[model samples]
Target: MWRDHLTQIIVFAVLFLGVSALGFFASRWRRTGSLDHLDEWGLGGRRFGGWITWFLLGGDIYTAYTFVAVPALLFAAGAMGFYAVPYTVIVYPLVMFALVRLWSVSYRHGLVTPADFVRTRYKSPTLALLVAITGIVATMPYIALQLVGIEAALKTMGLVGASGFGRHLPIMIAFAIIAAYTYSSGLRAPALIAFVKDGLIYLVIIVAVIYLPYKLGGWGHIFDAAQAKFEASPAPNDGILLNANNQLNYITLALGSALALFLYPHTATGILAGRDRNVIKRNMAALPAYSLVLGLIALLGYAAIAAHTTPVLKDNNTIVPALFDGVFPAWFAGVAFAAIGIGALVPAAIMSIAAANLFTRNIYVEFFARDASAARQAKVSKLTSLLVKFGALLFVVLINPQFSIDLQLIGGVIILQTLPSVGIGLYTRWFHRGALIAGWAAGMGAGLWMLYLVPNPATDHAHFGGSAIALSKLGLDTPKTLYVGFLAVALNLIVSTVLTLVLRAANVRDDGDDTSPEDYVADRSTERSSLAAVASESSGVAASRAAS
Candidate 1:
């Protein structure tokens, strides 16, 4: 067994290390003498052009978790796995609608974090602090989920055992490499490494879809086999088309996930890093290519069923790894494993940077030391990035590796709370800042309660139980069982809206100080002179060319 897995270990270490080196050196790819400013470290100098953004966002959004967990869910539960595809498909248009405004506003104000936007938008540091804290909390588990993907891949290759520190060793080592380069290079490293991450993932998935089917008999046979297996299952809750309950879960999770996607701090890091509105638009338009790949990858679940591949471990998370093992030569499986392993690095690096930015801009500067220098702030952020990665590593290694997947679900709920502040604030000042705060608190409270009530069968925990809402708990006669996150967010919005009217009627104070009413509608023509000044603040020409 040791000899069988040794080749994979060596390949993964080499590919992963090479990717880390690329990330560390990426700091030089778009070098500026002063890495002191948030522009340089936080947004990769806000200058990635269309091609780089596509690869970076592709690597950012479609992660190792997508590669390993989605298929595993499909193999284990059936149709629920494809939720990722629709969510990715719908996310771009949603991002396109709000991102330009966010960029213009952020550019105008020199906002480094989403909390900076919230702080300025609402004119309330407390509210912005909540949003910042939520982002960091939500993102931590997401970084860990990438590690879970690596763990699943390693387990399939027989590199580790099911329990104890042995199972965690691989994740710890991966996290160490991730933490090291991220500490040294900041956001540029991940942006540079994304090219390799996306290229490998694309090659592996494309080849798997075409090659696996031929090896497993044809497309028709694969479909037939999958249908037969699902049909023969004793559970009524099986198959691709969600029943009334799963359908609601599917739609809500997708929509809620789409809304939450860009709200995550790392996503904000990517969008703000773009050179201009055009780069943002072009990237948004082009990013669905990853979604196309995601749709193809989701079909691999059906392929797994056709191959009659049994998951090697106690859990079915090994479906994709096992499928590759069954069909590919061992050496090729090593290459596939490299794809999954390196895929974790890009997002992990980005998330670490985003979290560090939040701490540097919001907490360190705001409270700890208002007079801190930019160079000192950069040093603090760099260290914080390493700590964030290290914390995520501890979560995976100490808790259970599987918990990261569950925690990621919870992260979605936590991140969704930021939408009314970040997403809704983009188009309107109608929401009273105080009322918005009230709304966020209510939404976050309810979302957590609902998530807490749902229980996972595998772990016997309640609250975020499976995606389905048990109608039995609600005590109503309805076929529509909704996603907990959707319901919680709805509750949050209602409470916030009602409170806004009351606050307005009482003539309570609102922070209309930070942004002007006309600022939201300012296009390139009206805003050009002001925009040019903000763009020229530092490293303007190099930033412009890279973005161009």
Candidate 2:
């Protein structure tokens, strides 16, 4: 440990505690009614306006993992890491088209989770269960990545304890504060703290991009250094620009990631919390600005290359922290670390809330207690949120970080399988429930099989080492590799389309859709005016009143 780094630790601790206080107080922020319901606790009562929605969604998408891992990838592999930039850029317009429809349908039908939407749309609990379980499984490693980001920064600051459990104790304490405030304040905690979290992130990044390049030489020298380092490496594909071999992974990864981003339950939770469709549309149009920041952030890897800053333990993910520690003054470096630490909290809270809502609405309340009150659903969801955070904590503490990273790749593929049931179901219900389930299974199986077979240069060149699988593995006789999610999702769509045609021709009745066409497009007022009698007879009146 660098004993001289106490100043950074102190600054980090101060900002961390300050944000915890803000989170505790956020329980009272924007409160409309009792915080005893899923709508109130899990989704901020679905009442956030445009700006709150923007910060919440931004905080959820541009996470600490983005800060640490994207640059780390660029630091390690070169231009292929820049795929994150394009993925984030393309995701918003897609969001404008798809999620607004999802929001409309969810608001009209009292849906809290994507699984809730699936259950209501396809009228199949089994499919909903699959979606919920997929969400929970996919999210655990994501939350662990946040903890990994915090630990990386702490390790860089020499705040890591002497040895044993003490070494891990600092991060656990920080996450404990996050878990406590999240339990009390729920989604509102993250929504409120997002303001401070994003402010610090932007400040740190803006200062780094402007100051670091000036201090180190210039952008040209930085890129020259990065290109030289990658050129000296053994892999032919490593460089400042994508080559024939890596271009496939780069393009497919970008497209697959864009398709999968908003499909995550946390993103849905953020969007669903928006008070109206207009809020989501406006935020979607504006949120691509974060992608612009992301491109700048990814360049920090080259910045590190130019500065000659070495990663602690040669761990690539720690390079960003090490970069800050090397370049910035001690106090400001601490502030940068705080930015990343607090960045972890916002998304971690949102993700846990999302996973818990999936269980509470689609699993617990749907199965265990059909008559559960809103308060009870919220109660279960809160407790489940605690359990989910605890599970993620254990995941990072007990397991290797590389395994968690691999699972995150798998998570992308896993969540992408639900595109047919959730993303496409928004536009058309032509898909039979049976076909949708089969498509999900086919997609999941293909993705896992491909992952198990693919080897990566990063992971001792072993199978399941990364998300990219070579075309040769699939009989293409080439070195080009494709992102597993892009291929799996393609196969999923084909299976879904073919089976859909087959099932329809068989004249076999499957689980029927319960949602109407207007349900997919109506707001609260329009829903009430058009389908007032139907909504009143159903369970939607309560949601309609809350919407108003």
Candidate 3:
């Protein structure tokens, strides 16, 4: 057993060291003179051209959890997991509609984070804080899932053990390495590493899709094997396609997830990191290539069935890695492992940094200390990024790793609740800011409460449970099941709209205007706005020149 895993351990060591070296050296790759500014640290100088932004955003959005979980879900529960593929496909077009405008306004106004947009758009720091908190909360578990992916890979290579200290050893070291470079280089590190991460992932997936089907007697056999297994299962959800009861749930979840994807702070960070509007447009047009890869990756779950692969970890989340081990040579397996391992680091670091930027810019500077300087704010952001990474590490180590992955799904649902405040607000200022806050409160409560009601099939527990809402469980339900995320978001929009109208009727004042039509049309060349320079300048100059 130990010998079988020795090569994987060596591979991991090499790759982690390589990534760490890259992270440590990233500031030089896109170096400006001052490294202590938000532009250099937080948004990677807002200077990534088309190709870099494509790989960086691709690496950030398509994560290690995706590499691990989508196949694992397909392997365990049949076709339900294919939801990821459709969601990814639909998301780019949905984002394409708004991303250029988002970049334009953010760039023109020197917005560092999405919450900064919220603060300016609605002129309400309270609403901005709500968006920031939701983003951080939604993102923490998502980062933890990256550790879960690493854990799955380790377990497949027979590298994990139940001895408390030993099982956590690799995770602790990984976290330390990630946190070190992220603290030092900030967004630049992840932006640089993303090229390697996405390239490796595309190579691994391309090779696996071609090689695995051949070894298994072709794609037809793979599909036949998967179909037979689900046909014989007693559970109703074991098939590849949704039933009549779940059709709405599937469609709504896909759409809701698409809507929520760009609202994520990491995604916004990637969008803001682009060099110009054309880069954003070209990247959006190109991102669907990754979605195509995602579709093939999901098909690997069926390939697992054809190969008769069993789940390697204590839970069923290790299907893809297990498939890799069973079907590929040991050295190639190590490459696959490294692909997933590095993939996790790219997004986790970006998410942590994005969350930190939100806190430093919107919360700390907005409320507690209005007089904080840019250097001090950058320092605070660096420290906050460390804390965020540590918090994510806690979830992976202290909680069940399976539960952590489950929480990422819950995070998606949670993030969707912010659609009204961030996503819709990007397009229109019709919703009263106070109504937006009320809507956020109501949506968050309902989403959490409904999430609390979901029960894990394995443990039959309350929290970190399945998001599928059983129709029969609702008593009055006839024959339709619903995704908790869809229900929650629907209720969120309903409340937001109703409250907005009521406030308008009551003559409640709207917040000051922050964005104009021309502002949304401006790009990098048209506007030389620097978030760092503006942060260091007079607040009155910044505010009065824009909105205040």
Candidate 4:
């Protein structure tokens, strides 16, 4: 069977190796100075212009999950899978200006991670440590999910025969390559490789959308097939239409995802790498176009059903890849497989680098070596990245793939808890550090408990089932469920608000803010001391006091 797919295997190897070569070459792509500094290695010297930043951010945000897991969701869950589309649509407009402010303040302070921002904004090292730890923990499974995206494709191609260790060997080899380039080149590896990755994705998607529909009747027939399949199912929620029971869950999932998107350290890494506020602003405006593509991609699930394509190993994640292999010529199917493979590479690199940056700056340098030079920090970050990727590899090897999925779901909920501390902290210093920590603790507790209560009917798991939970769990008298992230964050905000009042009234001694109101507004164009020379080199900053 593997021998039958040799054409595809060769094509995939060629493209995968080519990108690995490009990853090594990226170290020289934009050589401002030595790659010794964390600023240079971890953040690409923070000099990415409009187009480069556009592709890099696109690569980071629209990952292999976009290609595999999302469509897989549509294949399995019908309309609920479509939530990714709306959440992406909602995120860009919301963060367009908000992130610009974050960029400005971070640029001014030479901040390398969101934890660094928290540390500076509240003058709380303790809170910064918490933020950094959350990022590293959250990213491990997120990276493992990326590997799943690739493994799904590999299995579809018949490259990995049977199951067990041999099935994952190719993935291990690919990540070994990824780990090497990432350690050597840092953020530039992903930033540069993103161009090739995005171009391939767009080409495959365009061809699939137009060509697949023609081959499998029309759009009308595809929908009819999907609708019939779902209607015949015994599941309570599996139609093209969103029923009343799941409506609240859908809305809250979308909104909560939108709010939590940039709060992830990897997303922030991409945004912060922009050369100026204008680049980020332009990107924010233009990036919604990906959402349109995402919706089209989700439709491929329906196309697979219309084509009567069976998933490899009965794994829904392999549906899109299986669809391509079943219908398209071997050559084009290989191309599609390569797209999914490269798709995994770009984001995995960025995520490892982002997590590494958090450790180097927030934990390592902050605690162990306060006077650590930028070069020393960069070395630590490079090593940390390898460890992070290894941890992700362990998740794939030792754990059930289902737990990887659940962990990613839980990862979003876990990261959302930081939004009040990092996302809101960017615009306002209104909340006390003690209150932020307490609020964070409460949100983490509630989010974990809610996730524990969720059960997966598909897998027949009794706990840690999924992201949505029924209102009855909270003593409400309805069948309507809400996103765990959405509910936990509301509880987080309430505790933060009430605690802030309590702490302020008690005159609790605050560490005070290290950032001035002007830090958000002033850029390199306008001098704020010797720092203005560095800040003016690029552009990005929000007004000191933006309206909430």
Pick the winner on lDDT between candidates 1 and 2.
2
lDDT scores for all predictions? Answer: 0.80, 0.87, 0.82, 0.87
**For model 3, which pairs clash?**
none
Choose 1 or 4, whichever is better by lDDT.
4
**Tens digit of lDDT per residue, candidate 1, span 248-349?**
778888898899898999888888888778878898888887888888887887898898898776656677878888888777787888898888888888
* Tens-digit lDDT track of model 4 for 1-548: 77888888888889988998999999998879889988888889889999999999999988888888877777777888899899999899988877988888988899989999999999899999999998988888789888988888888877775577777886687679889999989899999999999999999999998898889989999999999989988775568888789999999998988887888899989988888888888999999989998899889888888998887877778999999998899999999999999999999999999999999899998899999987888899999999999998888776555423455677899999998999888788899889989999999999999988998888777888889999998899998889999989999999999999999999998988999988887555464455665565533333333432
Stretches > 4 Å off in candidate 2: 161-167, 402-407, 525-548
Candidate 3: C-alpha RMSD after superposition? 5.4
Instruction: Rank the models by lDDT, top first.
Output: 4, 2, 3, 1
Give TM-scores for every candidate, taking all chains together and pairing residue i with residue i.
Answer: 0.92, 0.94, 0.93, 0.95
Instruction: Give the C-alpha miss distance for residue 360 in model 2, angstroms.
Output: 1.0
Predict model 4's lDDT versus the native.
0.87
What are the per-residue Cα lDDT tens digits for candidate 2 across 1-548?
66778899899989988998999999999899888988999999999999999999999999987888888888888898889888888888876878999999889888899999899888899899999998998898788888888878888987665358866676687568878998899999999999999999999989998899799988999999998998888885468999889887888898898888888999999999998888988999999989889999889988999999898765677899999999899999999999989999999999999999998988897788999988899899989998888888887676544423454666798899999999988888889888888998999999989988977655575676789888898999798888999999999999989999999999878877778988767776675666867766566767777899
Q: Of models 2 and 3, which has the larger lDDT?
A: 2
The C-alpha RMSD of each candidate to the native structure, in angstroms, is 5.2, 4.7, 5.4, 5.8
The deviation in Å at residue 6 for candidate 4 is 1.1
